[model samples]
Target: MQVSAGQAKLGADQITEAERGLLDFVTIEDGLGPQSSRRHEPDERTDQVRGRLDAVLIASRVAPLTRHIGLVPTVVATHTEPFHISKAIATLDYVSAGRAGLRVRISARPDEAAHFGRRTIRRTDAPDGGQPITELFDEAADYVEVVRRLWDSWEDDAEIRDAATGRFIDRDKLHYIDFEGRFFSVKGPSITPRPPQGQPLVTALAHQTVPYRLVARQADIGYVTPHDADQARAIVAEIRAEQQAAGRAGEPLHVFGDLVVLLDDSEAAARARLDRLDTLAGEPYNSDTRVFTGTAEQLADLLEELATGGLTGFRLRPAVTGHDLPRVTGDLVPELQRRRRFRTAYDATTLRGLLGLTRPANRYATTAA
Candidate 1:
């Protein structure tokens, strides 16, 4: 029942402050432009601007400023090289002392292709002779799997010091993951040592089978959108089945239901607020899943109901970030704690701890016979 703030166009400090309160996780959007829309303006320069206000810089600042908040910055695996991201997340873990997570994003838009001078990758349905977009998504899953392996190429105790013998590291503790996939090839051992958390955290959104496979086999957390409680249970069950098939049933793979929330003290007031916002925007905002428009208490109950159906948590999208995030952190969190559903104070310092997850073993560590 812990809350988190998804990416919003707010100052870094305000965002960090909100997480410091009762919110346990903070996801910072990195390098994502507006979704593909025919009428959207040309964003040739937006990419540069995004790189300027880099998510890593924001995370570094947020990590030190807040004690127990989980700082997860998005890393686009398609356009950005894994080498850079590995170092960045490792550095973030060092600075944050293991409070780092990553929202693994794959570039799905064709316009984004221009930024890298790569051909516009099309989804499965495109007329271009390219492989189906679905297949590309599968490739993306492979890409993240490779990144995960690279993150674990070095054991937690790989770095050793023996000034007397002039030895600085135990080479046996270092591993080569030499991973090659249909989309990319990566040679072993990460430039940086294993992150402070061993492997920090990797998460992704799964709207289809491709991502579901990735989430089942790779991610520590998976963000999923389901229509109702029944659908939520079904999705969770399917992912659990997939995990068993992939030999990852022993790992704690959290599935959080994704929702867009508009809260008020009364149900009528919340509905009116959502209606007014949609009217202000001059269009009906039809989301992929149902929107929760009610009091925080009512929303909390719905979350609990959904939880019973198998979801471990919820990722709320505020109708308007500036307006609703404060309510979520200030209002909803207290209500949940009052019910003894959410944590009152952080019981642990690390992000993994906040989530009730242990620091995982280094993947390179294998028992010798």
Candidate 2:
């Protein structure tokens, strides 16, 4: 899986030209940020850095311009309504011909909460105080459940479109997902039809137990940051255990390691490049994932080593987009291909197919049958 910042200044033409069937999935991150306490101040200067372009909308625009690349855009589950996000992703799947996915996120920042003003969060010294994180995760789980139900609300053959009989749809095939939970309730028979893939992929980035459980219970794929093979193994084990506890042990769950990479012809060159970048920025770049400064061949070796710890793939964060993205596509991908680790060409059309996931049966259809 390849990660790209959705808010980056990447033009449609650039994406079309750069995509040469090298990437399996291009994750467009919801760039909503500058969530500092200072943002809440009544200052006009902070406003300039506040808002971001909607990631799903950007993915929708890019869908028609590219083929065979999975477009997974980030959507925050906390502040947004589930009904809207569900239909939006379903529509994306339709437009992308079943190549849509969502990167699920939850907002914990007070500044982010300030944007909505739906509820006020109070901070305390207690372990469970200052806004319950577990509650947020629980709400996120409910949100995903609602979204999945909405996706399955309409059956595959709901639309008849019969000219002879003047039948447009089978009303019986449409289901009302009467979902009620602590956060919100949605009575959803989504406006959009059943997506081509039945369900678009759900993914989340996880670091600890709370998020690991989210991945186990809700996501198709989980992105993890591990400093070493031991950490990778430990994280994967925890997630697997969570899956077992959730009674989804048999399900296909991909745990991918996330890494920030700066690749060059040699390790020395890579280090030099990163150092220069840091110097230009006036601070060393820190990341949740381990930063890799090495040659493509060296990076391949590291990936193969990490795979031994049960990592199915890597979500590489390019330190510099123009420089590292090309190296990943042109250099690292070819090296991995040569090592028989990466695919030479895309074998499947749909994102789920590319990920080797079967299209799930509609829940309502199964119940009716």
Candidate 3:
């Protein structure tokens, strides 16, 4: 995942370069504020990411310049309106010719909640505390619910751009999605028509049980942080259990391990590179995802080992985007290709197609029939 701010042309250029490497997809990470190491507050730390561009808009800007790779942008579900996001991502799917997806994220911080004055997210420490873990996760689930419902509100072929007849659309094909949940309610047929991909791919990143349940219920792919193969296995097992519990055992859910990588020609060199970076930054860089400093071969070995633990794929975050992103596209991808783990050529045009997901039938269409 990459977040490039400032200019759409610059972001488009970066994405175009990534696409040339035949990578399956690229994610645009979006944030409401400067994301800090501190989960809740904005920081004065200069080393951290201080700014980011709108992920969906960046994906849209790059859409026309590239082909084959998936463009998935993260959207904060907590504060944003689901109705608007559904239409936005649906438009992205059309603009990208079905190579579009979205990553749903929650903003639970008071600082973040302040951006939207309509609600206040009280801290657990506060006298009248705000959202509990369950409340926040449940709200996110409802957000996804509304988005998915709106995606299915209009049946495929609802638009009839007829010249001979005076018809613009088949009104019967559009259905109201009257969704009333604890957090919010939506009345739809989205303003935008059904996307090219019936329901554009919905993805989320999960660390614990609540989020795991969200992944099982709503997401096509769940990005998980697991340090080792055993941990990966445990996470996958728990998510699988959740999926079954949610009565979605028969549906496909891809669990991808997220890792930060600093790769070089050799392990020693990679370590040295990271050491230099940490030295420059004045502290050792650490995150929820383990930072693997090694060659592409070693990374491949790690991925293969992790896959055995039921992780279908891995989402490697480059330690330094400009430096490590190229190694991933140039070095790591080819290594996987040689082992038959990665595709050599572009096999599918649409993001869902590449992932082997069949275009789902509209729920409204089926209900009407």
Candidate number of the best TM-score: 3
| Runs of candidate 2 exceeding 4 Å displacement | 1-14, 31-51, 122-130, 367-369
Which residue pairs collide in model 1, if any? Answer: 123-133, 124-132, 124-133
Best by lDDT: 3
Task: Give the per-residue lDDT of model 2 (tens digit) for 1-369.
Answer: 332222244446545534673576777767445433242233345433445578899889999988887888889898898899999999999899989999998876676677788654443335744567677788898899999999999999999999999999899999999988888788879999999999999999999998999999999999999998999999999999999999999989988898888999999999999889878756687877899999999988898888888888878777777777778878888888887887877789998888789998888985545
Ranking by lDDT: 3, 2, 1
What lDDT tens digits, residue by residue, belong to model 1 across residues 7-123? 545456656666656676777776645532232234444322333366777888777676777888888777777767887898899899988989887775666767678756666
Predicted candidate 3 versus true structure: per-residue lDDT over 7-85, tens digit per residue: 1123665677677767767778887777777778877887655777788998898898888878889999888999999
lDDT of 3 at 129: 59
On lDDT, the stronger of 1 and 3 is 3
| lDDT of predicted model 2 | 0.82
What's the residue-level lDDT of 176 in candidate 3? 94
C-alpha local distance difference test of each model: 0.78, 0.82, 0.83
Better of 1 and 2 by TM-score: 2
TM-scores for all candidates: the values are 0.89, 0.91, 0.94
Sort every candidate by TM-score, greatest first. 3, 2, 1
Worst 10 residues of 1 by lDDT: 35-44
